[model samples]
Target: MVLLHQLDFSYMFVAIILKQMTPEKVITITRFSVALSFCWPLPMTSSRNQIFGYKVAQMFSIVNVNLLLLPCFYAIYLRSDDIEIVAKCISQSICQIQSIAQTVTCFCKHDTLQRIVDELWTCIREAERYEKEIFRIYIARCGRFYGAYVAVAYTMTILYLWGPLFLPIMHVVYAEYPFDVNRTSMTAVVRAHQIIVSHQCCAHLCVCVFGAFLIWFTAARFECLGVEIQRCTDIRMLAVCIEKQLRLRRYAQDVISCFRFMILFVIMTCSLVMTLCAILIITKTSLLVEFMFLLVAFFFLLYLYMYAWPADHMKDMSLSVSRSVYELKWYDETVRMQKDLLNVLVCQSPLKLSINFLVPELSLRYYCTYVSNALSMCTALRAILDKTVA
Candidate 1:
């Protein structure tokens, strides 16, 4: 009961702070995110993401973000045959890989990200006109939801790291380090290092989720802008609407470019993540608390799909805006007005959020396809890994 109460209090407190993330705070977080990514150097030799040879490779030293916890990982797992320890090491390695991928991706898409941020700030400035405004309310709600999700993920991760320190709080033996049992400098050093990397990873995850929220707000903002466009009476006002719409479209392009890799990741991995969690949930395990925490992690991971939703919404709304312009009384306008109206061409195709034209558009339909593919893969894996009872 005390644990639950403490969790609730922590959630509320964190959420309160998170909701206050204005555009400036978001940029600060983005910079913090970029900084964390640089902690681990990218391999310049990797042909996939690198420009040349592995020249950008980070040193295998403590200061490097990705390698910062190598000592702690080894110290904790050196002598342990525990499943939790092995799982932790594997998970952390995956995180390091993702951090590396993101760092490289960020480097490649730095300019696009800046433009997206500028466009996002422009929307936020308009949205924050007053709390009672619809856009204000929508974004605030999104911020709260984003905060709650991030809080849950961070709490689970923290508990995974520090649970062994306290008795009852750690219902199961999750991580048993092989370091000297005594409170030595090494122990303190390892613990502090774990805390730092954990927070940095959490920041990375937060940036990912916040990006989705930004997409959601962008969709809603475009919808509002579309509504304004439809309500325009004079040619001048209509022209203004057309310009804003075009700008929003350009912003959409920048966003798509900025998060192309994220889109790819969500499309490819969301189903696999859930499938793994489902398998774990079905399989017997002694670490009930740990498994429950895993569920929290899975829940957060699934939200990666949220990024696609708003984009699809924006695409639909953009299509609607284009169509709605046709419904306007353009017949009554003068020849110059008609020429201007004719000059503003509607996009025949919907706005597509995609990865450089691969994997099709980012939409629920494609998401379902990825999920179905994952389910099939999971089924095959289970068949291969688990023998028949007969």
Candidate 2:
């Protein structure tokens, strides 16, 4: 009973701390991400001194991910004969791969990202009062989602980081080292290293948050464009709307180009992780490990969902620009205005979020298909596992 009380107290304390730390007043997602830049060496700044520091931090982050990968690979090799251990190690490896992919992509696309940030900030500044309100609403919505995501992610990290303290035989990561982790000194060293890498992983995951918010921000602009088009009272207003639409299309394309590769890698890896976890859940004997895999599988699905939801919405909103124009009282307008409206409709199509020739359009529909395929794969694996076991 006393132990239970202590656990409850710990939970309450963490909840309090997290609430206090949450960025409740952040009016712009870009601003919030700039704060993350200080921690993770993201290309959110142009200052020479800061760029030097960011390069150093970026190098350290890459080295840290590599170090984590070494032990994970070695552990997989040492435990190759054990299917369960191998499965666990592979899952960890996938996570590091995700971190490394995002890290390297960010590093390579530094100048491009800076331009995107600059353009996004300019959009924010040029927003009208109503448009600014739209942005604020979406920013708050995203902030709440991000706060919950971080809370859950960090809570899980803390549990795994300190798992060895509670479970005598469990280590933070299921990897083997040349030096015995059973030794107090070695254990401390390994735990410290794991703890640092785990936080670095958290930082990498924030890249997802940034991407998600950008999608939302773009969608919000499309919505604003829809409003502006619907309120067009003259051909002059319509011309301005047409020009804005062109600029927005180019901006959305830039946003998609910047992150498409990372998205592709995430989708592929997350799909594999989900399939493996599903199969492992059915075959694993340890209830704790099975539950862990179940959580992991669910998180991976959510990870895909985070992108799919915004991508789908943004596409819809962008395509709706034509509809918004159609709904305008254009029948009473001059012939020239009518011809221009037709031109707009002819040029407008859904701003698709996809990797050309790599995957289908990323949307809610795509997410459902991905989930369905994963389930199918899991079922086939289950049948094979059953046959092999029998």
Candidate 3:
């Protein structure tokens, strides 16, 4: 029994160690994959093509203002506490309202309860108004970062679609030292280098062609609301402003939907491409399967963040905003819905504070404590499974 206990404990320790190691390995591999993805050039070679590509890239960059970069960079650079503040605000509002509701529910007399509920409703309305006003400012600030983000997205998409075609040529020209076939003779090496350089030049030409197409497509399809906002001056323009705002919102929603679909397609395509590449590499060389798996894992992680997570978040936010907008039936109704939605959008304010601070933490703590109490549940299940198997 003592020996069996020791073996069980050892196995458990190993499992814990492995689990911790897995997250660290995943982080490392993901970093490398992101670097490689960003570094790889598309096929665009000729001077004319390069100029065209630059022009195309510049079009996207024009609207991709410093505003978009700021929030995203801040999010990346900010401490965990800052992120936690945003998350806490989101979850806490619901809890605080529920708590208020519970307190209001305690009154048994109908007349008194009605009076209390009225006061509570007034308080809720006032709080929501303040929250919305504050959130608008925050979102306006966040919009600055949106432009930079779009530029990055545009560049990444261009690279992903056309990068594979240039990989073989890139491999030939920039082959790592000790792997160069013509390394023994300087003349041979120079000739091989020239050929590889010419291939890269040709690849860049293709990049320019596709890049120009994307830029023109995006510029023609998506107009910047910021540009319109700058041009508005007349009072009668308010009607025009309203129409423009609605149009912009609809365009944003459509773009988000399209992006989500594009990401899904890319992830599926990349998965297949990576699988094929791995198979070819394994067949051609004696590289370890474990290393190949790690490489694939890295690519998947990059895809998960750059494609999957962003698409999912955008879809969720778009749906939420659309629903809130749809709920507006009258001027008063619109104001109220706007207030609630704004509270949800803003990373700060009490409405958000009450939900995050009072709800998820409580639930999470309860879950953790309960799981600890039932620590042997897994073991018991394992025993049952073993018996069933026997």
Evaluated against the true structure, the overall lDDT of model 1 is: 0.59
Cα lDDT computed for each candidate against the true fold: 0.59, 0.74, 0.33
Encode model 2's per-residue lDDT on 1-390: one tens digit a residue: 534554565556544544434222342433444333332233455588877777677767778878888889998899888877876777788777778777777777666667776777677777788897777666555555665565556556666677667767565677777766788888778878888877767656666667777788789899999988999988899899889989888888878887898789877877777666766676665776576677667877787788888999999999889999999888999999889999999988899998889776999998899889888888888888888889
What is the per-residue lDDT of model 1 for residues 1-390, given as tens digits with 9 covering 90 to 100?
645775797678757776555655644544454354442223223345563222254222124555444543673566355655555554564454555556566666654665566556656665544412545555565666655656665676677667777745532222334456357886666566666666656656655665675576567666677667667778889878878877777877776676778657644445545565556544544575357437544643465556766667777876767666777788987887777766665344578777665677778777677667666776776676576522
Which residue ranges in model 2 land beyond 4 Å of their true spot? 1-24, 27-45, 139-143, 163-170, 179-187, 281-284, 385-390
The sequence of per-residue lDDT tens digits that candidate 3 reaches over residues 1-390 is: 533454455455444433334222322322232221111122233366764554454333322322222332343344334533332222222222222222222211223323332332332244343333333333333222322233333344344334546544232121112234454595465444434333222222222122122222222222232233334443344346446445534443333322232233333433443444444343343344334444443543343333332232333333343333334332443454446434433522110101223222112233345334333443454456567657
lDDT of 1 at 74: 70
Clashes of each: 5, 0, 23
Name the lDDT value of residue 215 in candidate 1. Answer: 71
Candidate 1, backbone clash total: 5
Worst 10 residues of 1 by lDDT: 53-62
How many clashes would you count in candidate 3? 23
Most lDDT-accurate candidate? 2
